[model samples]
Target chain A: MVDDAVQRFCQQDLQLREALGAVIFGQPDAVDGATCALLAGGHLLLVGVPGTGKTKLAESLADSTGLSRGRIQFTPDLLPADILGGETLLPGSSGDRVEFRPGPVFTQLLIADEINRGTPRTQSALLEAMQEYSVTISSHRHRLDPLFSVIATRNPIEMEGTYPLPEAQRDRFLLEVQLHSPAPEVLTRIAAATTIETQMTATKVLEPKQIESMRQTVRRVIAADSVIDRAAHWVAATRPEDPTAPEPVRRGLRLGAGARALQALILSGKVEALRNGRTHLDDEDWKKWRHEVIRHRLVYSLEGELDGLGPEEIVSAVDRAVAHQG
Target chain B: MPASDSQISSRSRRRTPTGLRVPRLEPRLRAGRARILRHCSRRGAASGIAIGLPLATIIWLTDHDPGRAAFTAIGVGLLLATVFASRQRRRAATLWPRIWDRIIGSQSLIETILDRQQQPAGNPWLDALRARSAHLPLPSPTALRRHLPAPDPRPSLALTATAMLIGAVLGPFDPIPEVQLNQDSGSTSVAQISSELPTDEQLRSRQQRIRGREDAALALAGRPALEPLARQIRGLSPATTAPQSLLPRDLQAVQAALQRLAAGDPIIPEVALWNPLLALDSRSPMVTSAALPGDGASLALSTDPGNEAVTRSTALADGGSDRPTDLSPTPFDPQLSAAPIDSIQLAGTATDDASDLRLDTSVVTPPGEESAASWDRVRDDPQLAPRWSRVIDLYQLWIRGKEGSGGG
Candidate 1:
């Protein structure tokens, strides 16, 4: 099976993330979240307040992976054509025209910095491309590269002017990695590293297609029945309709993580396990990403901002409530 | 040394999906890039790039001269031809959209069914129909909405070639002429040649021909099977019009949005309203204006906050099954006097696994206002349109689900 070498190759894969950590520190979970997403053959959604090096972390990931990079900086004035693109007819010399042009969304790794900064209209253009891995324009269709992913970084605290990423956009991402401010030591290390023109070379280890196949292999990694059962139970217990859901979830919440939220855990769990060369998923893999998988999916009492009791807290509470079921 | 994060990331080689397949990306990418670059520079390559000619100025320079104009035009034509042919050869350009389009088609089916419910006439019969509609819930304390079986009929088909083309062009490129106009144009002989074009009259004629073809295409596409049905309804007496056709194009837009989201196509907001599903079902004539607000609120219960589980099904331990059924497969409820309908739809063209559930394609809604907002958001996505087009998926799953008196 290709997974064998990939399992062995995961050691190499692990090393790359490690190298990235040397330059960017204190956010092991964020790194793990991104790693898990990459291995699962899905994209990552990074959320945090501004000035947290979210952009830096994504850049480091791209550099470490040696994937060709493209970026779209979301702005309120940004149009759908600015990100997803449309056919732009450039005037040709003999009074003819140049063909249609594509936009920044077409790349091996697309870093959509401050994605929520864009308007909802501009924002939805990207949501579909992320899910379908394709775009339709001017009577034709375009497919994204196998390794194509939009590592969208969002600023949750600065919601005053930004539009929320649609729920469908949230659903499409394999992981929603939140970047906490780097600890003083990590910041110090980053500061020291940036003292110079901070250019480091990552060996060209794998091509986009190769990386894609490796991801498929990672998906094939085994997740034991019990682990799957635990994941399913955890998902069921979060829904307000589920009798087993927590008091907070049932009383205050409007919805719970349906089957897809459960799948995110199971799928990412397998990727997390295999990256460590472990054949079967363990409980820790799910625990590691518990927050990332279900955070945005939770719908708290309409008091989204006021009730401090968001999906993260509910998931943690549900995790506690359902521990015995595991 | 103990393994570290950087150690892992640094060593994480981009490997191929197949065994020992260190799939060569450099060549592939370079080839792709070369194709793009060649397409970008093809005209210049043949026409002999003029080092000093400002790209925009070159046209002015040639247009001013009577004798040199013809030569510039010929060069422009050849350059344009190369660029055009090379662009057409863009591998898999249509792949992603083609795949997504199939998903859109699949999702569009959901809107079709929902569209059936959206009558132009808001009347008592519509209320009776809502009460009668299999998926609509009856106003009750304990029970949830009664679901109908809207089964998916077909699998989607995706062309690989089109996908590659899409992926190749996802990155940004310097627009050849426009950039040259401002900065140093990579103008050599090729720039001059690529710029050559037909006269304005010829261009106008070509545009007219293309528009005509496009109109024909739109006419074919805009025509729905329901249009004839609509025509039949239009002929109905005014008395019956209110009862028979209650839905509007706006409602169809909402339905279309749902199908798009369901099929993993991106939902589009260009429609009349943002929250179509959550939009009030005023067509039910029995729905008195007295309880209008309550109707909107009651419909909100259809979705819930599903945070813990994303996409997994299993057989339960308490002699139960956790698998999500295709919505009341046989109508487990005794209350339903009608035989459970197995309304299998045309299946999606291409999917991850027709049998294996993809959380990306179909949504599992939450059962409250939160569910309503989230459902509306995702349903509006055109990318998810394909699954939504298979409108019956959620209903069918619910219909087939094991019905118990209360939550477990």
Candidate 2:
């Protein structure tokens, strides 16, 4: 009894996963997370060490989805005007006039590489476009493509000459896809494959309209009250001051995920349901992607940092607490 | 392809414009709820048996009726367990749908349908979900039974049965008898007082009476020959001052006096005969009057003359006595008086011979130390006079009273 649109989206989603998996060697979770973010019409933040293929994942996701791609290598000297275009003066045939020049962000899929290297002012420039799917240049609003999504990559090991993404900028992301180091077996395959003259590339598996239609179908996926309640409980358990918060969370976290995190969880869960050919959302759908959708939004306290508590530990504590409550 | 008007109307009729319909899932949910309640009741009953039987046994051990206690305790335990099971069932009612969904592997489709049933707008996805749920296999009754397994009653039943068996074997307890003592007077009864060994006050009163009788006997026996008789009486042991020994001692003293008379001594005056006769009749008021100082001088004068003349003058002098003439020799029977002395000697001989028997019976020991066999021997002894057996019985009662007072 699957809807035709959901069935079609599942078929396209399988091809997209295969296309991303070909180039991204061993990170299946990252591929699924990226696909889920894309299909939900939300931004994704890629976090991993160097040589773990964070940039490659962003690029492969853009290629596999067939969306118009744009790249921005963030640097310390990058300005807000460089990311979200500004007005410039030009000599016209009639008289001297000002013209609005579009930046690279006008594309459907924008890849912000080494996003943390940019200053706070430059990072904030993409926030509105990622959220509202529109850019405001000199009060002249410009709507983005219907399938606009940002796949930003950040190097976790490189702290030098980089500005950490602020809370406001981090919350704009629906999920932070963590790409782990490849296994030894996967590394041997990667070594033999990468040394060849022919480079690995992702072919387009889904059209832009199909992805937009999938996003609409994902939105239409029915989330029952129980699933929504479980998601709400999981997000609420992350806050340090919440009564339902576990001891580890109350001690290790300073700020919990907000309402936006709940929205991202249900929205991503719906996309996950569609990928699994389920017309209705289930608890498993939210539970499967809870860490990715919630880990980045949590802020650790000074004590927690001193105690070496991380976002992964906090999210795991929330998971155990919510499950025990059930 | 386009749908015909009739076909479109049929499709619209099949769909609920408001929300999704799950006709097949509700019955399964109801069955699951029933299974949950049944499981709760079984667990509650097991708990009730585990707690009730021991409580009933405790009540039975305290001398209460076993059947009544068991019935009351088990009834209360069952009532409480029923109430608790009902509460558990009510709390579990909301969880059956979730359990049903899990059992059937619907992946929360039932919950989704339930939630969708409240929504005003219908979605094609929800419609498709309902359609898919209709074809999903319903959970088998065996599966539901497995999901809610019956609580094991064997352990509880075994423990309860053991408790019941113990209660049946032990039966109701008998209450111990309590001893009551009268503390106000420091004594339980008059027989208790008489049967116990004499206290100092009683000893002094007996000694004073003996000394008065000795003085009257010395006044009446006014010859050198009678001095030896008085000395013999004085030589008797002081232990004979106890009331039980008084009768035997007096009899011995009178027998010694008659032996002196039979040894060719001059016949003593009638006043001398009064001492032995009055001693035998010590409870008579005439003996008390005869022992007065004025009667003693008259009795000494009566020893001075001829018998008839002296008896007449004594009767005139003792007219104030209740039985003045009865104390005279005219009323005395010599053979009858002598027969008592012979019987007294025989009784004393029998007592000496039965001393070994007394040791075997332990009748003379403290009543507290005496056993039932000792009391039976005392009662059955052929040689013990009825009067002495009665005295032993009173002695036993006195000892019991002493023990009671000490316990209190």
Candidate 3:
């Protein structure tokens, strides 16, 4: 019965992805990645230049899911309370009462645009809400919706005044989807679509209840032991201290992802398998989702930075090492 | 989300052979694995033949020592074939997963089935999976073979056969007649030396010397007590005394007579003509008569006492003037015969053919030259004497009794 529901949800989610793709022209991979993170109940970090449709993709994602959406334009001066909500004094009938004003994080989908523009303290405020789906403000626990997903964006070009997200905060996001400029043909199609006077609104492809149900079904999607083993082995090989790590990884890595990385791999792998209409997961999905899962979590060493090596190289090394196992 | 007991039991009731109803896919998987191994084995065999045949053929064509070439070819063929087969087998073993994927017609279904097989505890998800997969058709051996790529046989067979044919036909060839001609041409008219029986004059001179030694022996004996042995020695016909044809008994008699004379006086050694050609070369011992220009030269012979007097006087001076000289007239004194045989041998060439060369070790010399220039020609000849003498040593008997013997 659960497999049947997951299959139905997979079809619905693919339709939602198609709807988002129509709004975000020429970014099919980004749209699919965003849809996967949203349906899997995990946050996404979009990295790209200023006008590559990162915010537009997030907005389209909200519209297609029909989830209540909130936006916070993070700046250098932004405070933790500005994102997580703060207590305000309100006058009651007989005495003054302290009430909490819910922040933008209290929604189904929250978009933190230019998240690197905010200080590390303010950026870390969303870690709890992104990971636990709840915010703790002044001893008061406010639970966000179970279907909440934070879609954060950062402009890679303009970095003069912005504060980059710390590794701890970056690790909360399940995927860091990179957005690129569209090809000439796609750019032309985008120009044609924008010049027309007709207003385009994304149709609601999934409801909040359906998303919650899909998350449950995603959990039930069978991850075969070998697929889990493959993901675990790859994640283990990412650590420089791990015996299975290849030499390149040992040379360049300072900090490796923790068990959360493995969870993200298996979860994303399950989502990919279900999307492919397979009841059981396989290493193919794990390979497809590895870079997105590991890219944000890896902390490179000083030499690695000097050598201009990035997480993508180490992730590729880990992948090649695991591929040769047996 | 988990399957309930009712769902599992109900699915079990409707099991089909295509899916969950098949008790084990291990058998099919094992069979598929074996088929791939067999394919790899066949490929490895083809590779060995392709590589080994050409290599062996090249070796066979280039090797000059045909005695060892066949064995060398077989050894190299087996070594190359074994190395190639081992490498190919390793390559083929790594393709097992790909083979599994190809045979099952699905990407991860086999991994799923194998993963399920690893779990000892019952799994509701696995059961559900099996039930869902039950509707899909199982892969048969025929289907697997149909899915496999076709075998290739072009370059291996053609290249190996061509190499073998070329090695067999166009390899090195030399005929026996050409080899023989090369050997004969290499030996063309190089100077050759030959030895024969002594000439009549040389034999006569040798008999005269032996007679003189017998008379000296009788003198040393102090009486005619040695007369019988001297008579036996004189009975040797000087006209027909062929030293080459002397019997062992006649030599023993002469040796006994010399030993009796030596018993009377220890100064006497065995008397033999150590060199005939050099003895015949002196002016008085040989009378040279120049014949007509076309005919060979005529020569007369005699033993010269004048040369003997000169040789004896030289020996007496070397013995020191303080001691009185004994006029024993022994041709070979034990003291005079103390040097090695080759030091006293007159330089002469011996024949290479044993049939033409008769060596009388008792009196060693080469005789019977057609002319004086012929004797000179035999002495100056370089390639003939040292080489032939190494095989047939004629002067060894000059020192036969005395360990350090030489001429007077």
* Highest lDDT model number: 2
DockQ category of candidate 2: medium
Poorly placed runs, candidate 3 (over 4 Å): A1-7, A188-199, A310-316, B1-98, B117-125, B132-408
Question: B281-302 in candidate 3: lDDT tens per residue?
Answer: 3211112434222134232322
Q: What value does the lDDT take at residue B116 in candidate 2?
A: 67
TM-score for candidate 3, please give it.
0.55
lDDT of 1 by residue, B208-262 (tens): 5444433323332343533332232233222111122222442332344333332
Query: How would you order the candidates by TM-score, starting with the best?
Result: 2, 3, 1
Tens digits of per-residue lDDT for model 2 on B251-356? 3334445434422222332223324333323322222434432312111112333333344334444442333232222322323321211001001112222331
What DockQ does model 2 achieve? 0.51
Tens-digit lDDT track of model 3 for A197-287: 9966677888888888888777876765766877788899999899999888888888887788888887887788788887677778767
lDDT of 2 by residue, A296-321 (tens): 88888888989999877887788788
Greater-lDDT candidate between 2 and 3: 2
lDDT of 1 by residue, A1-326 (tens): 34455555587567767866665568777877886787676778888877676887788778777777889898999999888677766776788675667788888899989988888888889876887889888768898777888788998888688888877777777788888887888778767766778565444445565566667666655444555676788888888899788777877677667777777888787777666665445667766677788887766667634667776678777977797653
> Each candidate's fnat, in order?
0.00, 0.81, 0.32
**Can you give the DockQ of every candidate in the order shown?**
0.01, 0.51, 0.23
lDDT of 3 at B74: 84
